[model samples]
Structure formats: C-alpha cells, structure tokens
Target: MEQNNMQDLLKRYLEGNCTPEERAQVELWYELLDSKKAAANEAELEEDLAEVRTRLAMPFRKKGKLFRYPAVAAAAAVLLIISIGSYFYFNNKPSGVPQKANKLLATDIAPGRNIAILQLGDGTEIALDDQSNGAIAKSGSNTIYKNAKGQLTYVATESKEDETDNPVSNSLRTPRGGQFQLTLPDGSQVWLNAASQLTYKISKTSRERLVELKGEAYFEVAKDANRPFKVLSKGQVVEVLGTHFNVSSYDDDPSVKTTLAEGAVRIVETGGHRNVVLEPGQQATLDSSNRLSVAQVDVSDAIAWKNGKLNFNQSDIYAVARQLSRWYNVDVVFKGRAANVRLSGEVYRNTNASKVLEILAFYNLNCKIETNNGVKRIVIE
Candidate 1:
C-alpha cells in the first residue's frame, strides 16, 4: 500500500470506522514489519527506526486518533516498516548503564496481575487471588462465580419471596499492585484499577442500580431506562441510563476525571450542587473546589489501563511515577529535577519497573532503585 493510503486506513481504524478486512490487513502488515526488523542488521534497523520516529512526529487533529506520539501511528505505515523490538532490546539492556548500582534493589518488584478481595455482606472476606475458578459464594438471589480468566461475575436467579425486601450488599477491592473485573447483578460490567473499591447492593426490588467507587474504574453499563445506573465517586455522582465510561477519583490525585466512551452521562457534584452533561469522547473534570470543566478527549486513552497498556501523552514525570507507584506497589521519591521531565509513549502494563525506568533514562531522566528495610523505592534524579 502507498504511504498516504496506509495512513488513511490507520486513521479510519483509529476512528473505529475500519471494516474487518481492512483491520486484518493493517494488523498483518504490522506483524510483518516487526518480523522484518528482527532480522535486519543494526545499521539498517537504526535507519528504519529513524524514519518511523519522523513519521510519528507528524501532527494529527483532535477528531482523529489520540496518539501519545506520532511514532505510535508511524509504526502502522506500510511505507516505513520498522520493528518495535528494537526499542525493547535497547531499553532493557543494562550493560555499562549507570543505574546498575541499584539493580539488586529492583528485584521482586514486578508488575501487577489479576487480583482482588471480595467482601460479602456478612463481613466475610474471600481472597480472590487464591480462590480457584467456579462458584465462590451466594448472596441472596445472586450466584457469584469466578471464571477461568479470573473475572468475577454475578448471576441472578429467581428471587425467593423472603429475600425480595432485603438487599444484600457486597464489595470488591483491589489493593495496590492489583486489579479485577466483575459483573454486577444488573449485568453492568466494571473493571477496577489498583487500590480501588466498588460497593453495590444486589436485589430485584430497587428501581435504580447504584455503585460507590473509590480510585478508578471503567464501566460498561447495561441499558435499562427504567432503572438508571448511577456511580458515586469521591464527592461526585455520575448518572447514565446505559453507556461506556471511565471514572478516575484517586484520593491522592488533585482532580476527578470522568470520560465517556459512548452514549451520554450526567455528572453531579454533591459538594456544590453542580452538574454537567457529557457526550461521547468528552471528559468532565471535577477539581478540589467541586468546580466542573468539560473538554474533548480521546476516550481510548482514558481507558488504556483497562486494555492492559500505560499511555502517556505529554505527561510529567510525577504523573508517570504515580502510575508506577500503583502498579508496582512502590514509593516514588524525586530527588532532583526528575519531576519536571515530560514523556509521551505507550507501554504494556506488564513491563517490569526496571525496564520502564530504563526507557525514561533514554529521555535523560536518571532513575535508581533503592531498598530500605525490604521496601522498594524508586529514586529519580
């Protein structure tokens, strides 16, 4: 395919307008590019990589895909075939690296996996990480099951006459370095991020489906006009009949961001009685003073974590540190000018802390891993 044609297809794919065949063709081209790069010599590899970076630096409009960097989109261009493997290979190498002094401290601090704790209404806690797949517990008219993929699902059965009036509430929590997904009694699905909690009541009597959340979560609400789905996070409440959206309300973060992927939502700030409505691809931010602001955004970037990727678009070092702290369950200490550094890229969530820090080093941000009484700390200078 020609360069312009390939770029057009990629734009269409990012905009969710590509047909199945076109999507497959682009994917196959990407695979071939990676394979070819793997077999290329160092000189040829570097040249192709430079072209990839140049293509990535091309500016795109807001209405198109929100790429953290042009290099991300450039990788899909058939005119310039570059392997992404070179980046990983170069960034992961530790030979003659200055940060090698603290290499030993980087051990054991790995990426997070599927893990959570399920608390029944009776105050009984089940360690979801240790539990095997299958039915785990029963809450009133709901049957809680853990699937082979570690997702917790709720199946509603015929409600007993005695349980109709009494609704039992259950809570699911993901500690630092953990994450989990669950299907609510009403069929609404939610993916909870690290150090987050979600509480919802399961009953057939209630006309509204409501959930309380802390930290961050991506919701795919089931449509039921009669019973509106509502989410309460921090001091804000988001009400929607049925839609796909994400909410970020981490206590340590200064702002709460609600991004909608499809349909519509109404955000109500309980602290100030303020409300705002959001459309698809729009984000509403609530600051400390309960002030609300809305802006156009790339919904895919907002839900990147749920898709197993960390995306940074002109984000500062502190923002990157926050993500690392949650995923690796480690503390980040900025010693010098590290916090001012800005980064833009996409990385798999499963990448090790050391590898990620190494990539930061490429951008002139020095980092080292330190251990104090067995607790790992990432110190940037």
Candidate 2:
C-alpha cells in the first residue's frame, strides 16, 4: 500500500471505522513498533521517531493547513502504517492476538517501596515506616529521628561522662520489597537496598567511623581527616577518608562488587589476603576464589536501584530474576534454560511485576508468576 493509503487506513482504524482485517493489520504494525521502541535507547529512539514524524507530515504539507489530528494520534498512525511492510515480510507464521503474555501469572506483584526497620542496641525494633516524622528514639547522647521523607537520621547531644562512656550500636535493615536511607551521627549518608542491612555505632570519642553491611548499600562518607571511614562486607573492608561508593555482597551473588562513584577507596579482602585501591569510576570485584580484579564501569548503573530505577546491562537471566525477587518480595524458580539468557535495559523500579515480565517476554524470554498458599513464585523458562 502507498503511504497515503496506509495513513488513511490507520486513521480509520483509530476512529473505529475499519473492517476487522484492517484493524488487525494496524494492531500488528503497532506491536512491531512497540518491540522496536523497547530495544532502542531513549535518545536514538526519539531521533528515529522525529524522522518518522517529518515523513508523516509531508502529506499535510501539500495542503495549506496543518494536520487536523493531535500530535500523539498522528504519531501513532504514522508508526503503525510505517511498520506494515516489515510486519508482513518477517512474520509469515500464523499471527493471532499476542496472548496477553503476562496474564499467565496467578497474581500480580507490586514493586518495592520506602520501608525498613531500625534495630537499636538495646534489642528494640522500630518500624520506620509506621512512625511519623519526629524523634523516634534516644540512644545515649544520640537522638534518632524519622524525617518526613521517611529517612532516618541520628543527631548527637552533649551528655554527661557516664552517658558518654558506653557506645551503642544501631542497625537499619530493609526487608524484601523495601529500601531506606539513613544519616549517621557523623553526617555520612547511606542508602540501603532491599534485603540489606547496615550496622554502625555512634560514639564521639571513637577514632574511626565504621559500619558493617550485608547485601547492598551506597555510601557517601563524611570527610573527617582525623577519623577514617570504613565499611565491612563479606569479609572485605573498604577504608576511606571520604568517598561515594556502592557495595553489593548479597549471599546469593557469586562475587562482592564495590563500585566507586567519586573519590577513592582502599578495598582489603581479609580472606584473600589481597588489597586494592579503587579510583573514581572503577569497580573491584572479589570472586569466590578470593581473587580481586578491578575495571572501569558506569557508576550510575551500579547505583540505579538507590535512584529508583533498575538498570540491567547485559545481565543474565538469573541476575535479573534475583533483582525482581528482591524488589517484589517473591521467590524465583528457574526451569529449562532460563539462567543463560542475557538482557539489557532500564525500567522504573515502581513498575508492576506483570509489566516487567511482559517487557522480558519481548526479549524472547518466558516468565510467569504462580501463587500457592499465599506465596508468590516467579518461574522463568
């Protein structure tokens, strides 16, 4: 069909005046365009669409008036009509309605949210999400507050000698489908990922500011020339005067990855008897064999979760499943050859599980959610 004829057909289809065959053809064109948009990067995709719009505006240019249709509607019609040829040429197999791919799931799972628990030194657990913005607790000279934005902060007050004598530790932990940020007494900031924990002590007299981490967290250390900051995770200790970095030491993950965003850090692996210094934009990975390696990487991708986005760049199916499991609080079971497939893209963390699975299906990977006894499981094939 000519461009002009195809555009007319699409306009009729959009207006619900097309025959069944014409509607199917338009819908198939849209499906192909959506698949291409999903695979293209944001900037490149926008450029390509702009060219399409120019070509689509030619017919209207022949007339003295502008296109009567809205810009969005016009763009959609153009995309549908342009893909008509490719849709028929490449897809010769019997084409039925795409089977609402993600609907096979028994239940839809939601994404992670800002939620965490704070465990005080005295064995008290405070649900940070339940508490309002105010002073929640007091630990010796340190006052703990949950701010309006759901962040936990620690402020120190002058105390008597007796109260200052004993140093108390506090831990901020995020359950599955939850994440939280914290401001330490010394002014350092920490963003904890889902299913992660960070423990630190508040003592003005302490020479060093140290914290232990499990799973993943991004840290922005406060500069203290006299006191170095240290993070302990999976038998590895990262020491710095002041720096921004991310650490991932989840038990299920095979390696401990530390990516430096700014400044410098010295990573020491106690078990491996190895030490390495990482500069800005460098990542150090300590594998199961206790070997440490360094390489340059995109720092934003490493900290995307803390920024409320999921960046999967050449990530294997198992890695993608692990992230989904953490953010959705669901168990994942892989059958067949699901673990070997790799994917790359960025999506909002707040998107629902069904939409996420649907995006995965566009990459030719099969995934479904199953619920049994109130527990949801994602099976990838």
- Per-residue error for 377 in candidate 2, Å, reads 1.7
Query: Judged by TM-score, which candidate is best?
Result: 1
Worst 10 residues of 2 by lDDT: 89-98
What lDDT would candidate 2 get against the real structure?
Answer: 0.75
Clashing pairs in 2: none
lDDT of 1 by residue, 71-101 (tens): 3453234223312333222334434332342
- Clashing residue pairs in candidate 1 are 56-70, 56-71
Question: Backbone clashes in each candidate structure, one number apiece?
Answer: 2, 0
TM-score of each: 0.78, 0.75
Task: Count residue pairs with overlapping backbones in model 1.
Answer: 2
lDDT (10s digit) by residue, model 2, range 1-381: 433355346445433456767756754654556566654434444444554445434543213544333333333444332322234322332231113342544478899888999999899999988998899999878888998775898887666643575678989999999999999988999999999999998887899988999999999999999999999999699999999999999999999999999999999998758899999999999999889999998787899898887767668888888999899999989787654555555556876687567546545566788889888888877
What is the C-alpha local distance difference test score of candidate 1?
A: 0.75
